[model samples]
Target: MPATSHPTRAAVAWRWVALVLALSQLAAPAVTSALAGDFLASGATNRALITPAGYAFGLWGVITVLSAVTAVVIVRYGLGSWWETGILIDICIVFVGFSLWLVIAAQSWLWVSVVVFGVMVGALAHVMRKLIRHRDDLTCPSWAATLATVTFGLYLGWSSIAWFANVAAAFLDEGWSAEGWWWQFVVLVLASVSAIGVTLMLRGTLGYVAGVLWALVAIAVGAAQRGSPVLVSTAAVAAVVVAVVAAVTWQRLGRRARISPATA
Candidate 1:
């Protein structure tokens, strides 16, 4: 019998679905840009303190590259197990939803952007939970597991912070008073706490933590550019605190992974 005949109909169907989703990862950026107009300009129109530096948005390029890498990984190895397939589905939702978000934002539907972000982040969170729970799955080789986890982890981490920023921008668009510096401080504090909480929950996945740290540092830089000394200091402190927790969590996860090698 041919090797292709071994998989059942469902397995074959899944392979095709996985391949399409992986390709979508590569296509998302171009489609998003075409439909959404200039994301940075849109962001600037309703900018808030939580907003990171314009350059910080460049992380999307890193993500796109990682997505390309993930696409190649999936094609080369195939979906090794249901766990991987599920993660792929959730990630596709994120990419598609994010494109939708930019389109909506372009129309100045600020509240709608918030809701869209909420949905996208929820999908990302689902992927994170699955990755954390199945970290040691023997069905997936080390390289596949690492690549998937890191890719999704980065997505979730950035989306987590982006969600808060979306909400703030929405509020600002409504002419909600951000008159005082204190409100921005409060939001920054809340974001930091939330990032740290998620990091601890995920056992310090390096990719996710790196995403969070990247956004936080970028937020500080943006604040500096805006000449808000107080905001800059607060964001910097938050980044440092999250970094410490992430370092510890990453170490712990590594130790656990080594001990449990094949014991997902």
Candidate 2:
């Protein structure tokens, strides 16, 4: 996927849409904070051991920028030449789902927000699964490839971690207790396994691994703060496992990249 000089009218149109999308995402935090007392505060005590630190949410800034960048390059691969029409439609709907989530979340509709996010995540996951499976078949320009990888990977990865927190929030609202150490332990273990499962499935896409790593490490922080060594250790171990797998995968990929096509 070499760089291309031609950015079509369609690319410009996509850029405009991307601009709007970026602006919308930028406003979401402020809008939600004003309407619902900010996401972290809204989580309150029910969020222990699962909520990332206040600094962690800063990652949204990165995603917002990338989302905009995606617009610029999406059709840069020669005006929708690389993407299947269905894939493009799915991408559009996924962003719409993103906007909807912000609205629902702002209203403090926890369960509904969860559902919206689940849909959003599912859509992106579908795209990403297809992408990984058919990367070589993709004819997008270099920039398009990079932008798509970062944008979709981050969206899928972060949302995946957030989904767990969202579910936990709903459970807490329904009379669930953080005091249930046994249940918390079980949940942490399962989340750990799921993160590993995702890593295996993606073959260690860094964006996906990074998101799980962020959530797991942050949860570990919360656990340590609350003096739960068991949860902390589990979180740390899970994070380490993911990191190691990612490293190994990258090495193998590098080796494959080095092999000549004819040799292979």
- The CA lDDT of each predicted structure is 0.74, 0.70
Residues 1-264, model 1: lDDT tens digits: 112223335544555565565556566667766876677565633367667888877787787678667766655665455465666666667776766776777777878888988887788888788767765542545777788789878978887888787777777776765544677778778888999888888877878988998888998887777678898998899888888998887787778889897786
Model 2 misplaced stretches (Cα beyond 4 Å)? 1-19, 44-46, 75-83, 258-264
Could you give candidate 2's per-residue lDDT for residues 40-134 as a string of tens digits?
A: 56553346556555566677778777776675565444223344454555666677777777677666678997898888777777777766766
Q: What are the RMSDs of all candidates, in order? A: 4.2, 3.3
Q: Tell me how far the alpha carbon of residue 215 in candidate 2 is from the true structure, in angstroms, after superposition.
A: 1.8
Model 1 TM-score on a 0 to 1 scale? 0.84
RMSD of candidate 1 to the truth, in angstroms, is 4.2
TM-score of 2: 0.84
Q: Per-candidate TM vs. native?
A: 0.84, 0.84
**Candidate 1 worst ten-residue window by lDDT:** 1-10
